[model samples]
Target chain A: MTQTLGITVDNISVTYSNSRLALYNASCYVQPGSITALVGPNGGGKSTLFKSIMGFLEPNQGQVDISGLPIHKAQKKQLVAYVPQADEVDWNFPVSVWDVVMMGRYGYMNLFRIPSSKDRRLVKESLTRVDMMDFKDRQIGELSGGQKKRAFLARALAQEAKIMLLDEPFTGVDVKTEKAIIDLLLQLKDSGHTILISTHDLASISTFCDRVILLNQTILASGKTEAVFTEENLAMTFGGIPTIRNEERGTRNKEEKISTIGFD
Target chain B: MILDWITEPLQYGFMVKALWVSAFVGIVCAVLSCYITLKGWSLMGDAVSHAVVPGVVVAYALGIPFAVGAFLFGFGATVAIGYVKENTRLKEDAVIGVVFTGFFAFGLVLSTKIPSNIDLFHILFGNVLGISQEDIIQTLIAGFITLLVILLRRKDLLLFCFDPNHAKAIGLNTKFMYYTLLLVLALTIVTALQTAGIILVVAMLVTPGATAYLLSDRFERMLAISVGTSLLSSILGVYSSYYLDAPTGACIVVLLTLLFIAAMIFAPKYGLLRRSHSTIESN
Candidate 1:
């Protein structure tokens, strides 16, 4: 099989029915086997961009091409796995963790067919990878925040996709769980899967992501971590509000003074 | 005593046919109700059931089989409600409340307007005591088709109900899934109306499923348990009503309610009363 990897966004723009412009002529290419962090402030179109790329939302202009296939025309959608924000799901729904993870194979399983032994094995392996094999039979409503995130991650892993789009996978998780998840993402990246994550945490961007796309409705900056995390670019992306600047307080102060940007 | 009640009812052909029809309707509604409960569309089922009343009244006035008018008007109401929910800002419950009540009230007014000696109570609360052979055959046909559709689309339907976002991500036509489910629901409601009436159909569709939810964690098991409980309730209620000379629909609803209360108290893990008791014990 041909290796389907890499995604190219060419001048993509999106607007909602309420006449709110989300993305404006945004353009970027996600290289194969790279971990990219899409970082932005609240209401910065990060989720919108993710949704457009996933073909859930149609762009008003330009195009999104995934592995030489237009996103709209992509045949093997099973190649891309998406883990939506936990808050978007209803926890009270009567489903087990295993049941949720098994859903990842729905695309591959025949419409009328039951899960085969191979599918079961894959589900088990995915759960084991997330160290959630013990909780497979547990109800989703009874899980902690971190456990819920892990279970969702297990579902994505069961998809066996080449690209994973995770929306704030580490939000509201404990420090240990956060580190574990980040480490797992790095391992997946090393194993030749492309991972794109959206996060509000700038501190982890430099250490965890190979490239960072600073987004505030559009691509404010896209490059290596060191280049995109500049104090000036950070100030601009965050609307002149300084991010937590414990380590780079002097640098941010100097940049603010030089740039004459007012911070409320 | 049990043999006497069974033999006495068996002697009457209409009574035997009524029991058969109720059994078939009970099985079909119970199986489909699993999906309705899982999807949180119990109220939608209620709305569809009530909306079919106007159509039933119209068909009676036109000297046609009540099922024809009921199916047409029932399906029309379902489509109208679906369109309103998708196109308007009105919440689904509010839309359902308005549509079903409007149609049912219209049905009541139309029933009063007609000079025919048709007993309106028979239509509102099913006359299981007077089921004809034709009714039995019709219920059987509807039950078979509903079961076939459900069996064929079981996996897809399960995935759609549990995680629609993931279903959409996999390129499944989620809009088709939604409409297909509503279509099946309409069919089930129409078929069940012959045995349980509109008011009691909600109990048949919701109570068994809710009880099953409290008992099982797996979809297949939940569906199986719901069908089992519904069949048991239908048989017991029908027999009890035959012996005691009570309303069959009311008896069935009462039986279902008792089963639900029992499940709430005794079922493990998901049961509310059980969970509360366990919490108190642990504390």
Candidate 2:
């Protein structure tokens, strides 16, 4: 049976260390076997949301669940995988792509036991899925930016997780790499895996993702792709002219009144 | 003449002990240095090494094992640096600088004030020629434990140092991994004490792995290369010291430094002279 996990974020809020900066308050559900894009501006708390979901940061209030179990609990069962931003990785560290992909299988085996044949086969298969089998022996640093992203995706796929969280997988990657990633993601969704990607780039939302969560430090809107991805929602998420015009109106009115008075 | 040079050192029990002792320190430090270089913790290693000076003095005053004091203050300095970085706005470099300088100064003051029969220069610069049998056994045991732990957990530490977030996401105990590396570092420093001393410990901890990193892009090869450099340098340093009438510790450091310079000039793809980036940029 191909089991999939649905994600639930119930009133999650985060604050910065004994400070008044309430980074975000979010509530959304990501259905199983679908691609949900977390859309927001830079510093719009997108990465913060991803961090909280991955259990790296403790949310001030609320819970994240995958298929009715808590995030950590689901994680302990080897049901979740996360691909960090490419820039966050240490490219200079000496490791091969095969070893990097093998890292995903670490959670399945107990300490001291070598990876089994089945596990090794899965790692090979994961690389094949991402078209990186040829580069398995290559050191990760030797790969190009796009190839690096593909290898990272292979690592995540090798996890065999029901839920995958990718942060900025498309950022700085070329068009072909992005298309390859999209194709692999669609294949995953077909095989009953849930994937949530957090990115600032909105262009890929309509094409690659089936759902959208528009965010600006808080949940502005979220639903099926066609229902929630509106001009107004995007305007709000990107701080487009509508929101900027409101502040502009106040200054413009004041200037007009001063000119009408016609005095130095 | 070279045959006499090699046989003369083997004649004395102490010289034989020092050679084996230096080799043990070289192997452990070389292995641990792979992670240190990868994690960009060279300065941190230097800081922790100097920070242990007061601990050694205090342990001597209190009549406890010097390793205990070194471990306590080594971990303490790391924690203090981390605390200062988190609680205040100080960057890691600044925090490390302030805490290490303060601790090192405190150690110096304690060394001067206490009237102990221990040679302060020996404590600072090491006296490999004078290490006792018990000291050799301790270094052997410490080196064994460190090597065992690091080898058993090599994959985990590699992932943790390379990408901690990915490690944690994959259910590795990154906190445990972080502290384990620190503990290994402290233990490795303890092992290097009698041979390298506190002053030369940083060199043993950082130089070999750094040289190896420039030479290879595979961690396994890097380890082999690092251990090879460390063992070669230590043996050469100990051997040349007798004929040159120089301190064993200083001799080891000078050899390691010369090797580092050589690696920088001649390393395969990344060498200063053979780099491809410069050619590409020129085009």
Candidate 3:
């Protein structure tokens, strides 16, 4: 197998143009070929970290790299793919699902962005993988919330990038769609793709994610899911965990051999 | 009578020139309008279009190329808007509204103060009927370049407009895309100013695209439909202006507005008529 490309964020800090400090000396390493959940509350700098890793927002303090390469260089090599939050998209855009999925192959396409035969095949395969082939020609805005997330997931899949960053993929999706997405991420992990997903859905973390990063403008904890997803870390990240523990009581799995993180 | 309605305007030299210039300008404006409209930058288009008036007045005073002055000032207005939006708590629409009106008022003041035979009425409303050969050349060049750039960079620009974060993550220079879009918008306004003037140019840039948006579900189709609406309106507006003895710019804008209203009501899937029909049937 080719050398696995993992994400490394080193002491990065981000401050928005509005003088709001979004991240402060934050650092973490996503192991190659693993699923890492960045669990944080709303406005906890998860999106900021994703943007920093994607080279969209330059850090005020430090650097981010993918597989020991500078972020921009990694991006040019098509080493990363990102699925932005639904709120970041203009749903009323005129592009069809096929058009949006086809954008994933743009890095491989030439200046005019005419798709090659391979590009076309990959787009079709990725859409079919996400079960969105039936809606390929439909306008993107016509899809359900879950379907829109799947369409964007299909876009990320089509990029064939080594590292995938998804921001709040579970926010608006149904339970079944969420399971399907998690299963897909597992398949990607097994294939040596490094994946980082930021979400507030704590219940699913222990089931499939190999690692968890508890964050609230800074890293509260970072390690294997069982070791780092403790109640104390959760409380620190969420500013008190009474509601989380109450919800966790109802959904604790029957097989308690492995420590499970749940707060639904 | 139909044949004369078509051929009568073709006989005049100025009419033929106006037709060619407006056709070229219409296509450019229509194409760029799709990006402007979809990106929710209609107010940005308004800001830039109005901001060019001062540049044109100054260009006339300095005997420089109108495009240069117009682009500089139009681009300056966008910069000013960006600066204010970044620094202030005010929203984007408010910033755009403030800056454009300020630039336009400055131009109005300057035009009144400047000692020249420049027709303030023509600057405000356009003089397509009295267009010069030099203006035709300038319009064609600006329109051609704008069209070519958009054609080549269509996908990147589309991605940037639709989801800039995704565009950035995929290694596209989104900052470049942003600036390039603004630059093209300024150029499009310059091409449109000669045909539609300061006040009506924003309408020319908005109506065709919005009409096509109502009529089509896909981007490529949207482009084709907008270009069709614009080309037809330009030809018909110029021809009807000859017979009706009206200002050509107002005639073009009126026709485009009428077409937009028609599309809003009568478009196949998204039209108000179809929506109402579907509601009635469901009941």
Candidate 4:
């Protein structure tokens, strides 16, 4: 089993270059070998938190440590992987699915980035895992939204990182793709991978994720999903009243709540 | 007759030097252009190439090598654009426009004020046929380094251009990659100045990659096609200039534009004609 690494963000504050305080003393701890859903409204510093944890930007206040190591050391050890949002990349870029997936092995390769047989095997295996091997040679722009998401997921999987951060993985994907992604996340959890995902899919959070972090610039509420995913907490996180739906209330009510809550 | 057409240009020493230097510049520009087009930095290329004018003029005034002044100004333009865009609310395109044109105008003003032998017409349009031996040496060395850097860092650069966030997550220093790309862009613009000049160099940096983009769906293939298109156009452009009694730089850019037009209409998958035909077939 892979040794999953926990993420510890210690009261980090991130201010943008324009002097906008995006995240303010926000802190969250994601346990090892668990799935955490980071739920928040737009402009709520979910991205800021992710950036801080990934060391993409230095936190103005505190530190981010992965397991026992600093963020940069964890990164150097390839212990973390990030699947960016669909809008973060230019799909019209001239790389095929195979080429994008092969990038996962670049850190392991030498300066020229020639993929060894092992790297190729890992790429093929990850693509097959995501059921995207059939579209390996196709350009990224030709893929459906779901397939693009899967291709990026396959890239993260190929990285063999113990800690995975997915920024809004469910947005703009079809239901089938969403289901596949959930299943893959579950499997990753079972294999002892620590996963943190920021998403607006509130109902599904209780379904698959073990823990939930409701955030608005700072950590509002965080604990087991059943405990932290309350109506009041949702209201605070989304800055609006949210009607909680029991599992027995059916997906229709849950979906209605998702729409009415305005987190989407 | 065909043999004469091919051999006629080779007989002249200047034409031979022009052919060699232009071809070398074409390869480097084409390679970087793949990244430039895909990264949507076409305007940035235009900005840097134009911004190098003041640098060249200063080099002439101070009796320094043109490459040094050109590189400093090209690099300074990019830095200024970045700084202004970061500090202000203006969009990147606006920043680029403001900075590059200012530098270019400053160069023109300086040229008029300084009593140097620098010809503004030649600097703007290029004088590839009359390139000095020292300029040829500078261009070749600079181009070689730029080509080597692009080749060695191709994968990282591709990732950086495609999805910087993903590149960052994978422990890549995206900032370093960003500056490395800028450095190469500056170097490439400096080298291309000899063959294409300040104004036409952006065409050398853009058209080939764009044409290849329309023709191929793969990055590697895009690169190959860009190189092939650029090299063919360079060789043909030099020969056509010989026959037409035209500027070598203008001929090269015209050829590149023509090839781009041909690809836009005739490329297999993404061509306008192909799409129209497909729609007709479906209808």
Candidate 5:
């Protein structure tokens, strides 16, 4: 069951030390027990926003709170889980799928403490939920792109995090994998888990996402998917929508070039 | 016959000490090298090892323990590289190259200024056979401490090396992990000083883990393989040195290099002759 809590981001702004302004007075509240899709064009500050919420990159102004608690306080209680951009990770790291999943439990235990049976059971269950139980013994590097994404989801699932943030989870995933992930997110949301996913797959956004936050160097609009994901907003989000409205069809795989910059 | 072959090297006390010091050096280096290779910090290892030369030489002149000097320079080099990398527009590799070279040059110049009795060559090229009891004790203690820390924080370090973003997301101190590794690297270099010396210690820190990486996809297997290769190379290096009448450190490094070549040809996935994948991850 999910005990998802709302995330409150005040008028936070982030400017890197190099004077690069990544986010400008971005503010939004992620409603509890709902799935929110963070949609943005390339270099539109989606990942930066995610990092800010995860307490990875601090905001120069304002603060982020989880259910009225500071981000670090919530994180110390293991209240948040994050799945980074798949490309940001080194897949060739010498770890088994099982080992990777076990890393989720690192937050629950103290340093040098071995994983207990409870942790082991959770890892197995999480892998089974992601349809990666059979691949538990396999190396993470040996997995296909879809399998790799599933493994990451499994790791996040094992965190038992009330608030989950996924960045570009469906970038290179297969249709089957994407469908499975959407189903999982829906199911998690139903259980009251707060899920934030950064993605470009607009087709799925209309289907599963309860809320959509359109970002372009800032939060463009955030509300019900149908309410916020209109033609005007899409145009503004991706610089006139490129004569298209996000064409990530059933054709899945990284090699299948997405209709990028708003349309193919 | 097997007994005699094994017992022959056990005859001399110097050989015994050589083998003993190399064993500790091999295992510790192998263990720490896994993290080093995973994080792509081979150059850091090189930088720290070379930077410690002046520290060791200075410690000798100042009547301090060489480890204090080595550790200071090693840690200093790490901070300098980090500072240069952050403060300037230069890339990490460029910063590493510039900072490490400067420290090494400083070390070389300082070596000339020190009394010749300090024997800087021994620091550059190890004299494992001439290792005093004190050196042996220091290597063992330092290796033990460093290896202990690595083992204790294995998963945290592993996660940090693989995905620092996720590590920080999970509330683990990413900076602490980064510097802890540097701390371990410095300790390992000092432990390896009497056996591999400054120049060869980098080889010990990189070759073992890289070889193991070629052999396995799982981290546990990689650890076993790395430790096995390192210990095997140590024994063979010392044994061959006795027979070939060559230097122990050179022989160990040569043996390690030969093993790496063998792995390059025979490694199931990444080997030159056996490359099965079109584009493999370069560990």
Candidate 6:
């Protein structure tokens, strides 16, 4: 029997301690082997949804099932690897790039057991995949912003997880590093790894993503990249605010325009 | 020089006992502080050290071995800080500040009210010269146990410190690891109080680890460097205090501070002075 990398969200909702509802009755299914870009304005519940899926937060009213296992269950966490925003880590922490990547294997290795030769090899391979092998011995604090993000990506890649949830992986990264990361994600998708990334860069959405999930407190729309990027849908998803402008028009206009664009 | 110092100290049984006790405390605090410094819990040492004062005062008032009272009080303070940090919006440092200051102030008030026979200065600044043989053996046993526990759980403790999220995702009990670390820290601080005193215990807990951090990125190397620095500083400080008629705890802390400053200037990689020099050379 063929196995499916499935993510089934059933009526999930979340409310912060200050009594603000971050998510409300949101539901979506992530199909296997695809890049799904979750895009929205800041504080629009994108990160909250990703955390909920990773079982970091208990939904106030719904369930997330991944590969037949519930989010809260320990077995399900093994199937999903999460790359949190790089800014969340303390760079002053005394550790090398290799050490950080080795942490990815912690989920598979025995909790008290030392990493074996195989684990070391996997760390090296992951670093090499990110083209960071030359700087393996360098401390995390010594790396640039883009390098730090790539190192985190290598750490997630080393987890060998079936599904990867990345939050703002391309934020503040230079275009070259961003393209390299997107290329790596594309390769991973081709290799049957389900990838979901939360991002704000609408320009790269069509080029890098196979599908787009536009969320604003709830799932406004989710479908093929071309179908979901319509001007009307973008305005609705962004709270009736237009985000794109044609430079050829020379001046700003509030009038809505529908344009067909190919992936760059 | 080593033989001369060893023989002269061994001639006086008390000196020999003091040296052994200091060594024991040095080893225990050195190993335990590696974890504390790495996890950014260096300030917890200061909290526990000051928290023990009230326990020591109460025990002295009751005419008992002060270690029992101090252990209970120090461990209680640690737990209180952990509890408040978990249950309230207060940060860890704020919780520690409230808990330690309350206990320390209570101890200070009690010291002033109690009989003049017990010297308040002696309690605050420990007298390594007056260490009893029983104290030496007790500290050795505690140190051995602390070392064994650290060695056995080194991997788990390291994982918890570096990345707790990954530790949890791996099915490791992160809460258990955190509390276990606090317990070890409390025990280590209580043990070191015998030799370094409450005022200087933080020096033993923080200085050597911080010095090691400047020198190495590998955890194992850092542990070794910290332990070595602690041992060397303890012996040198004790000998210098004996010869120069200085306060032992102060002498030890001063020596540790000097070593830390030297490492900050001389060590490669993360050292500030070294980095500046390298930058100049590159330019």
Against the native chain B, each candidate's TM-score is 0.93, 0.95, 0.97, 0.98, 0.94, 0.92
Runs with alpha carbons beyond 4 Å of true place in candidate 1: A1-4, A8-28, A57-63, A70-72, A75-77, A240-264, B2-8, B57-68, B105-119, B281-283
Model 1 lDDT tens row, A73-119: 45256778889998878786767999899888877887675799989
The sequence of per-residue lDDT tens digits that candidate 5 reaches over residues A1-264 is: 233488988898998877889999899999998999999898889989988898888798988988678887787777888887877878888888998889888888878848999999999999999989999998887889889999989988998988899999998899998999999998998888999999988878999999999888888899999999998999888977754523543344555555342454
Model 2, span B153-262: residue lDDT tens: 88888878888887778777888988888888878888888888888989999999999999998999999999999999888889888779898988998999899999
**What is residue B51's positional error in candidate 5, in angstroms?**
1.1
lDDT of 3: 0.89
Predicted structure 5, TM vs. truth: 0.91
**Model 5, range B1-283, lDDT digits (tens) per residue?**
9788788989899989899789879999999999999999999999999888788878888987788888899999999999988788888989989888888898889888888466777898899988988778878888999988998898888888888877766677889999999999999999999898888999999999999998889888999999999999999899888889998899999988898899988998788866645445442
Question: Which residue pairs of candidate 5 clash?
Answer: none
List clashing residue pairs in candidate 2. Answer: none
Give the whole-model CA lDDT for all candidates, comma-separated: 0.83, 0.85, 0.89, 0.90, 0.88, 0.82
Pick by DockQ: which candidate is best? 4
- Candidate 3 residue runs with Cα over 4 Å from true position: A1-4, A242-264, B87-90, B279-283
Using alpha carbons, what is the TM-score of model 4? Answer: 0.91
Residue-wise C-alpha lDDT for candidate 4, range B1-283, written one tens digit per residue? 9999999889999999999889999999999999999888999999999899889989998999999999999999999999999889887889999999999999899889988999899899989999999999889888989999998999888888888877777787888999999999999988899899888999999999999999998888999999999999999999999999999999999999999999999999999999999999999
- Give all TM-scores, in the order shown: 0.86, 0.91, 0.91, 0.91, 0.91, 0.85
Alpha-carbon RMSD, candidate 4: 4.2
What is the Å distance of residue A24 in model 1 from its true position?
5.4
Candidate 4 pairs with clashing backbones: none
Per-candidate clashes come to: 0, 0, 0, 0, 0, 0
lDDT of 3 by residue, B1-283 (tens): 8897788888889999899888888889999999998888888998998998888889888988778888899999999999999889898889999999999999989988877567878878888889877877777777888988998998889888888877777787888999989999999988888889988999989999999999998988999999999999999999889889999999999999999999999999999999999999999
Evaluated on chain B only, candidate 5 has a TM-score of 0.94
For A1-264, candidate 3 gives per-residue lDDT tens digits of 244598888999999877899999999999988899998888989999988988877889999879888888788888999998989887888889999999999888888899999999999999999999999998988999999999999999999998999999998999999999999999999988999999878888899999998889988789899999988888888987868766765777666524444432
Residue B98 CA displacement from its true place in model 3, Å? 3.5
